[model samples]
Each structure stands twice: as C-alpha cells, then as structure tokens.
Target: MNELLEVLRHQAAHFGPELARTAFQRGLAVTKKDGTRQPIPITATPVILEAAEVRRRCELAARLSSAALKMAEAVLGGNSQEVLLGGLSPLERAIAERTWRQVSRLATTRVDFFVGAGQQPRALEVNTTIPAMQGYSDIAARVFLEVVARHFRYPERALASLLTLNGSNALALYRALLDGYAAERPGQMPETIALLCRRHDAQISELQYLAERFREFGADADVVHPEDVSGDDAFIAHGKTYQMVYRHLFVRRLEENPSPWIEDFFGTVPGRKAVFLNPPTSQVEEKVTFALLSQALATPELAEGAQLTPEELEAIRVSVPWTRRFRHGPTGGPMGESLEDLVATVAAEPQRFVLKRSWDYGGKAVFIGRSVGTVPYNERAQALYGAPLPWAELCERAVADPTGGGYVVQELVETSPEPHVLCTETGVLPTSLYVDYSAYASVGLARQPAWGGVCRGSMAEIVNIVGGGGVIPLITAEVAHKLLMAWKAL
Candidate 1:
C-alpha cells in the first residue's frame, strides 16, 4: 500500500466520521479558494527516491549547516541583529546582550530541526520564535493513516496510535536538535503553551486541535487573540480576567496589523512570548528582501561568527553580473576591479546588466536595458537621473512599492531543463525546472547585533520567480554549518 494513502486511511479510522468530515470540508474550502474544481490538489507525480541523490542532498545539508553556523556566530557577534531581528536598535553590545537572553531562554525550551526532501534538506527557516506546522503535519499523518486503515486492517496500529507515534517522533527530533542547548539550561523545558492568533472562527478548529494535543502532553494550553489578553490576565482566553499574561503568542494571521489595543497588550505582558510560527523577519517571502539583500548596500552576515573570507566574498561578487539601470558609477568611468568595484562597473556594462532600484522587490520597476531599446533606456535614464530617487523613494514608486523594502542586483543563474510535474484542475501538467530556492536558517549563536542588515518582505516574489521559469535554489549551506560548528566549539 502507498505510505501516504495508508496514513490517510488510519487517520480516518481514528478520527471517525465527524472529524474526517470537517477535514473534508476544510479541504473543499481550500480548493474553492484556489479556484479549483477538485476538492484536493492531489499529487499524481511519483516521488522516486534515488539513494545517490539522497546521500548527496544529506551531505550538502550537513556542510551548509556547518558553514551557516560559523557565519551566524560572526554576524550574531557583530551587529547582524538590526537585519535579522525586526524590533529594537540599541548599541551592538546591548542588542547582543538582549538577544543572548532571548536565545538562552528559547534554547532551553525549543527544539530546532529542518525538514525537506532527499539528503539535501533545504534550509528552512528557524522555528525558534513560533514553531508552527507541527500540528498540521500531525493532522496530515493521521489523515493518511485513516486512508490506509480503511482499505487494510492488518495490524494493531490504529490511526490515532500512528498519529501519536508520528507526533512523538517529531517531538523526539525537536528534542535531539536542542539537546545541546537543553543541557546548558537544566529546568527550562516548555511546560505551558498559549495559542495566539486573531479572533476568527476559521482559526478555531486548528487552535482547538493544538489545544487537544497540548493537553495530551500534560501541558496547559489556551487559544486567544492579542486583544483579549491584558497585562494582568493569567491566561489567554476570550472572556477572562486573570493572573499572568500568556507565555507565548502563536500568530496565525498572515496580515499582521497590530491595533493600538493589541500593541498595548503585548507591550504590557511580562513573560517571554514567541510571536508566531513564521515571524515577520522572514522577508525572503517578499521579493523586496531578495533585491535588497543582493545590493551593494546590503551586507548579509553569512553566519554568526564567521566572515566570508576575501576569496568567498569575491566569488559572491563574481556571481552577480553588472547592470546599468541602478548603476552607481560615472557613465564613462572605468569598471571596478573587485565586487565592491562592480557597483560602479554596472553603469559601464549597460547592455550586459539591468538597472534596478536598490529597494525594488520582484521584477517590478526593473529596467532590463537589453529587453528595452536604447530610446526607452535614454528616456527612463533621464527621469531617474533628473529626480535621482533615493532608495526609499525608489521603493515607494515601484509596483506596490517593492522598492521601499530593499534591493539587490542578481546575476541570473542558469536554470536546469529537466521536466517536472504540476497539478491542475484538468490534470497533471508536465513542467520544466522552474522552482527557486527560498532558504531559511536557524542558527545557535551568542548574540544579536544592534545595527546591521536584515531582509523583510514576503516570499511571493520567490514563488512568482519560480513560476516564471527561474529554477535552481541557492543556499549558503556551507556558511550555516560553519556557524553551527563554531558555536558548538565555543
């Protein structure tokens, strides 16, 4: 039997008709939202596992993890906090102190792990502030188990038991990841959890599911919105006036518009709080972050403690081709000799490179001189130079103000030609390689920097880019691993 199908069968058996019906309804709703005729976006494509590929991916992940850890320490040790952490901008040392405090506290209770296909587990972002999707995975596993149990009842493993086992496995993975940190902080295991989200009926089901799971683990849990909780409230509940504030706030709402009341509540609450499963700092979701991170002005701290050697930095410079639209040098000046020099070199290589606003995200407001004629380039150049929009201004003018976020000049990477599968209402579509890698990182480092570069935006650009024929995911796996090892050594 298919592993996934089997899991779904077991899930149905354990959850019974009512829960399964609810899940079916939810799936239907999601399909409607996606404007699809089918209730589920089933994957008809076969996932063939090649042992060699798996080993390669795994090796890459390990190497990347090491490199990332080293860079993390350097960046963390310096002033990368201004970029990575969203709020607060004190001196570097002070920021470092506060960040260390936060990290230490979290290290004790949180378990970190990365999940992806093959050996090269794509670098997903850290689950430190708000670890989400665990419950989702659990539910998915249960659903699969149910599907399997309905067709074949061969063993003692019921859907519920399988789900329990899966959940336990996930938790075990988390614990192993955090074993080092937990050993340092003896008694800070996470005991109670508070599910923070917008007060919406749609979210109730998921929150309720989590609450049940937390209860199963013998931990007290509750679901509440930020507005419902006050400084004096002991628990986060809709209709309650109690003791201490909720320990953690799991943000479920995608659009975060903190009203005055909500802000005041969060500010007044004393205990440590995790913002959401995916914090706002993950700007890679936003194309603007990529543009900004790629710019000369943007300095990505490769890791916590490791600095890119001159050679590595040079390699990065070489990777990015020059363009004229957002060039920084004089029109007729000689090109630069180093990566830093290319900032000026771009102006000279008008045909080879595209000029973009330093703050623009996605392909918006990007002037591909090669695509446009000389006449158009001259006209746009006049407007751009006449006004000479600052980075902030350029960002505001870009489509939906993609430039307002940040910018970078990326030398396009060659994409693979292999065909892949995509699901549609009609049937499965055979597509070519077009997926872009949006890598995430969770590093164990000492501190957060006071003033440095960090990218903030949505991952929509990456998805769009991938949809638009851009393939090949780029990750700093070597950098990540180095940072991890360095921290471990320390």
Candidate 2:
C-alpha cells in the first residue's frame, strides 16, 4: 500500500509545476449544486482492497450481468427483432446492433468480475455510440508515459509513439489527420487544423491548450468560433489552407445555435474537411441505456448477440434487485405489491428503501422517505393518490419535463463502512468512496473483440481527476487491459 501510494504521488508530481498549477485552478472550480465551492482534497495514501476481496467483487459483477441479461431476454423473448430492429433505419440498425454486441461483450468480459457482498456491478448507462473520454483517458496515459520517458530513462522505447497512434487527444487527433493527408498527397502535410468552438471562456482556455500543443508538434492550430468563418468556405484568413477541421464545441450547444451560414460555408467547399469528436448522435447519451437495459423491451437476441449469458444475467438481477418486480428488498423483505405495491412496501418500511426516478441522473429527484419521516410520506402519498397525475403519472411527467427524467425505485445500496483517503495539500485525508460505473467503447477491427470498457472508483475521485484535479486517475488502461485479456481467453 505504501509503495503504491508513493507511485501515485510521484506520477501526480511529474506533470510539472505548470500542470500542477492548472490542476489547482481547475480544482477551485469544483462547485456543488447549492453553490458551494470546495477545494479538492489531495492525498498520498493508498486505499487498498485485499486481493481476495477484489476477486469476490469481480465474481459478483459477473453474476449481476447474468441476471440483467436474463431479465432482458425474458422481456424481449427469443428474438430481438422488435427491440433491436424497431424504429431504426438500416444503417442505424446496423450501428445499434454493433453497439449492442460490443456492450454485451463488455458486460460479460468486464462487468462480471467486480461483484462482492452480493453487490454486482450494474450498468449505470450504456454509451454505445460516440463515447466521450476516450481522448481524455488517452491523454492521461500519454502524460504518464511522457513523464516516465523523460525522467526515468525508461528503456528509451517507443511506447509513447505507439500510444499516440491510437489516442484521440486534440493534438494526437490533429496529427493523425495531417498524417492521413500526407499519405494521400505524398509531399504535403496540412498547414493547419482549425478548432471550432463556442465563445465561452472555458472553451477558449481548452482551445488554447490545444493550440499550444499543436504548435509544439510543428502544426498550426487556431481557435475560431463558428461565426468567425465566412461564406460556403469558412476558410481561415491565411494563404495556407486548412488540412483538417477539429470540432471542440459542444454539439448540442452548436446545434441549438446553428450557424447555418458556417455550415453552408463548410458544406460548399471541396477537399476542406471536418471531424466531429462528438457528433449529433450524442443525443443518445441523454437516454439512460441502463434503465433501458432493465426494461422488458431489451430482448434476448440482443443479449445473445452482445455475448451475454444466463449466469451473468442472473447476477445482474440479483445485484440490482429493484429490476425485478418479484425481488426482495435489502433487508430480506418483500419488494412492492405490483411495483405499485412497491410504493406501499416503501411506505411501510420507509427506512429500507428510497424512491428513485426511473431515469434519474446526477442523483436528482431522489426522495428518501425515511429522511422526510412518516407524516410527510402520508401527505405525499395522499397527494399522489388524489392528484390528477398520480404518483407514477407525476414521475412520468417529471421525466418528460426534461429535469426529473423519470425515476427508478431502488433500495439504497448498503455500502461497507470504510474510511476513504482523500489527497490534500497536507497529505491524505479520510473520505468515503461513492462508487459509480462507467462504460467505454473503442473502434476498429482490433477493438472489435472488446466492445467497451468498465471502470469503478470513488465518485469524488472520478470527478476530481476528470475536472483536471488529478485526484484518483481513472482505471481505464487497467480495465481495458483486463477486458482485452478476457476476450482473448474467450
């Protein structure tokens, strides 16, 4: 544990003073919904789970996947013709099927191994199409590789070069486009890669980092808002032509503020190109695929094609007991009467369960009946029964309203009491781990075997590191390697 902690600290320090300062600045930006800002706690202590416990967790994860698959199959029947094929164009259906297969395989290969204490890893959501953070993870790994190379004289191998070829970081991606251009044209490498972004300060800062990095690699990169570019040729001002366009803007935001003129400008030009890091298909992210997975609509054909099995499906159902109408509560008590019966069951034993919206995100619209006490429950229940929109109806309205996003009734997961270590300026501070799961996907024939990846960590750590605080680095490479090995074994 001490050795691992030292490694983590060393890794964090290796990014240099500038990166550290940037991380601190970003750390200050951490704010809660209540408008409270909190500094990130940086610790130099290892939070170690015993190897035996880790194995148990992995086993439980497998069992949960089995359960979820079974439930999905029972709902979909033997064929996924309706669930998989419905409301999709041929191309869309093909893509969806591919994604489904990848996610299924990923679930079987990765998710099944993280279970413990009857706690199976349930899918938080499935991001089958246009998954974000691939670039981010790649960048992090690259940063680590760079540090190791510079200081340790680590064999002088070409690991960084190999890794760079596969990564999608802003710099690496632009370089790839240039390399492709050079391949086609023989003598020429594109002079510049234009980054399109909104006029936000944070976006500007990100683009600046990208621009600086691009310059470091002998390429000119500039930040241009959509409005700045002109005509059906949103060409840059310089005599040099843009070899590639990299979109850094938020897709939804850009769509909301459609630069039709800019679109026309780009569309009209020949040989001028653009690549969207996250294209329009990102709307899929808004739909909670995890909730969809638990639904009867997700068929067995879908599960089988995705590489799910009976055992994995059973495990999922057991871990996420709320999915089944018949499953019992956390305290070995019966669940709901009809799921409507669940309301009554929850009402009777408020302490044992909480009402979760079907498609809740970021922990909103989560009503803990025990927290509110019995009197409020009676009032809310009465209102639920009496209102034009009954409780279920109200939940549906909330989900549809774009804020609540429906809800799922879930028994609170009883996490083991463990002291968490938070990295602080002074050193390690004790904290609690709020575990969540993330699913990732990779492309190409090489990536086909393992459709996606799963990573588990304390929620605080994930948020901190993702927000640039460099807290607990995500286990992307570790998890990816594990899944890849599993796929090879299969």
Candidate 3:
C-alpha cells in the first residue's frame, strides 16, 4: 500500500510541478455547483491490490448489476412501476419515465463497496444512472505512471510497457458506448458522439477528458450541452449529426435547470432521433434496489417472473449487505431471523444500520447510525426534520415522510480503514482513511466492457469526491512491484 509513498518520502518528492502540469492538461478537476474549479483530491500513492482481488470484486459487481437490470425490467414490465419509482420530484419522475421504456439494458454502472477485514467487498449502493469516474481513473493511473517514469528517467519503451500493462476505464467506456450504439443501430457505426451534460456540470472537466480520449480512440466526440442540441427529423448539434448522445447529467439537475431546447431535444428519445447511451434510469438508481436484493432470498416473490439466477442470488447473499425499505410495517431480517416491525427494529438499535432516502444524490439524505451522535449528521438531521432527533426519532420521522418510496435501512458494513497519503495541491499528508471501491460494469450490452474501478477515501463513512473525499488510485500488486523494481534499479 505504501510502495509509492515510501519512494516519494525517501527520494521522489520533487515531481510536483510535472505532476500538476499533467493534471491540468488532463482536466483532473471538478467544477463546483457554483461554477468554480478545484483540483480533485487524490492520494499520492495508488492502493496496491492483488489482480485476483480486483477481478473478484468486478465479477461480483457484474453479477449484482445484471441482477439489478433484470429486477428493473421486471419492475417496469409489471404493473407496479410507481411502487419503486414514486415520490420523487416531478422532474425526477418525468426524467425517469421519459426513458423508462428505454431500459432494456444499462450501458454503464458503478457498484460501490466498502472493504472488510475478510476482504468482502460490502456493497453500499448501485449507480445505474450517469455512472462517472472512468476518465478520472484513467487520468490518475496514466499521470502517475508518466510522472514517475519521467522523474526517474526511465526509458520510453519501459514506460510504454508499464502503461500497456494497466487497464483504462476510459477505453472501457468508449467500447461500451460503441457496443450500445451498435445495439441501438445495427450495421450503423457511430463516427461521432455527443457527450451530454449540463453547461456548468461539476464533471464537465471529466467529460472534456472523455471527449479527448474518444478522439484518441479513433472516434469523434464533442462535450456538449442541451442548449446546443436541436431535434428535427433527427437530433442535430452544431450542424453535425451524432449517432449517439451520451448523457452525463443527473435527472435531478436536469429537472432543476434546463435550457429552452430541453423538452424538444429530450422529446426525441421516445422517437429515436438519435440513440441515447444509458437513457435516464432513476428507477434502477434508487437505493431501494439494495433493499430488494437484501430481501430477494427471504421473499422469493421479489425475484418472481424476473431472471434472478441462482448464481446472482448467491452473489447477493455473499457481497450485498442487508438493506430494507424503512417503513412502519413488519418485515423479516436479512437472514430470515424473525418478523419485526421495521420502524421499531431500527429505533431500538440505530447503530447497526444506516438510513437513506430512496432517491437522493450527493450523499445529502444519508444518515449513518454509527455517526448519528456526530455533529455533522445531527446538524443535517436537525436542519431537515426541525430537530436533532435521536437516531430513533430520526428513523420515525423518515418513515413518516409522506413521500412515496421514502427511506431505506441498511446494515452498516464495518469498513476496514487503511493508511494513505493525500496528494493535495500543496503537499502529501499521511493519514488513515476509510476507503470504498466502486467497480464499473455494463448490463444488457452485447458484452461486458473491460471495467476497472475508482477508489475514494475519507475520514467519514460517507465518501464522495464532490463531498470532500479524495481518490486513491487502485494499482495491481504486480504493477506496483514492477514499478518498485524499476525504482530500486534506479
């Protein structure tokens, strides 16, 4: 874990200018909601992991995501779409329904997990809509390799070999985009794609990088906003026709802010003016899907009429933590332990679980039982419910929110904290931080893409890049050892 950190502390702390230069040219940054830019918080040293372990987590993620895709289809195909997709804002709901029929497959998804002592990738949530960080992960790995090689004066061929040995999520995303585009338009290859997002969307920089990568991969792509797109007999942007429109914007954000061409451009989707990669999917993105997975074994009916294979069910049992819809009704435990009132069970022992809104973003509606007494959680609870209700009251108030599909109670996955060195703008700071692994996947595409992952570490349990958590690059042990040998020989 400290392989790179050890070398940096002892002999290579002088590569900041070059590293920062790579970051700037690569757009390794996040634009704030208020339209300001800042360097993405990251760790100086990548988290060295076993190749087998990375494969295991990604395999688990794929199974779970495939199960989720089937579940979404079953839910949508059944008579009860609103049972899971209700209570959201009108815009969020419309955004979901607009593309509801378009969800035969999920083009891209990133399943998030916290690592445990036994090496269990305890999944917390699944992001089926607008799954990002592909480009960022590539940038981190590529920049680290480039800077380290340049500083140590390694031969160009050695550096090229090292870069080849690593996987690129950007390449994975590009392949997935093409695969999805092909499925949508058979025999029609997409020469150009439009990366869709809000004008000042926080990940605009990342989208820009993705556009650059797409070009390098021999396809033409442009980062564009809704305002620039027009829908005629076909969707057109800047007088050019794109075969695919990759949406990187969130439904909530789209509902909150949109331009004059929003309705017309979005309206073309049902008619297929142009293929929309990963069409809006608020239904599958809701946190309740975890609860459904938790209950799948207990309630076999949840998997009824859906393609929940035995293998996927086994995967859920092993990796997915216990989760349930937070309500006042009776429900069985994840282990089929006993029937208990959902609200009462959580009220008694809040520390064992986490409360989260069925559908919310940026970790704003998450209330961790472990951190209930902490000031930040309390402040957020007080602000939302008009009082810093004890964990019990908090759960009750959350249950009573008239909103449909309200909150979820999830078993707290005790994360194993590890030491890391933050790669801040100024300098590196060594500290122990809780980290989570988020692996990428594609469900319903012709085939799965070569998906790697992104790691974010933080002092708090709720880790998100935009919410102040820094990223830690994931490096295979073999790759790290190779770099170490190269450094030693130098």
* 1-490: candidate 3 lDDT, tens digit per residue: 4756688555434765456556756877889878878887666667778877777777788888888777776777789887676756776676666666656666788899988888778888888877888888888778877887677766777777787677889998989878887877778778988898888788899999999989999888998887788865666889988877788876566566655465545544423777776776667777776778777877889876666999899889888888988877778765566755878888887778888888877887889887877877977787788777788888878988756478888888887677766665555666788898999888778778778888888887788888777767677777777777777788
Candidate 1 lDDT score at position 399: 23
Tens-place lDDT per residue, model 1, 69-110, is 333334345664443333222222232333332332221111
lDDT of candidate 2 at residue 174, scale 0 to 100: 48
Better of 1 and 2 by TM-score: 2
Residue 144 of model 2 has an lDDT of 35
List the global CA lDDT of all models: 0.33, 0.40, 0.77
Q: Could you tell me every candidate's TM-score relative to the true structure?
A: 0.47, 0.50, 0.94
lDDT of 3 at 395: 81
Worst 10 residues of 1 by lDDT: 448-457
* Residue 445 displacement (Å), model 1: 10
The candidate that achieves the highest lDDT relative to the unseen native structure:
3
**Error at 365, model 2, angstroms:** 5.3
Candidate 3 versus truth, CA RMSD in Å, comes to 2.2
Alpha-carbon RMSD to native, per candidate:
12.3, 10.6, 2.2
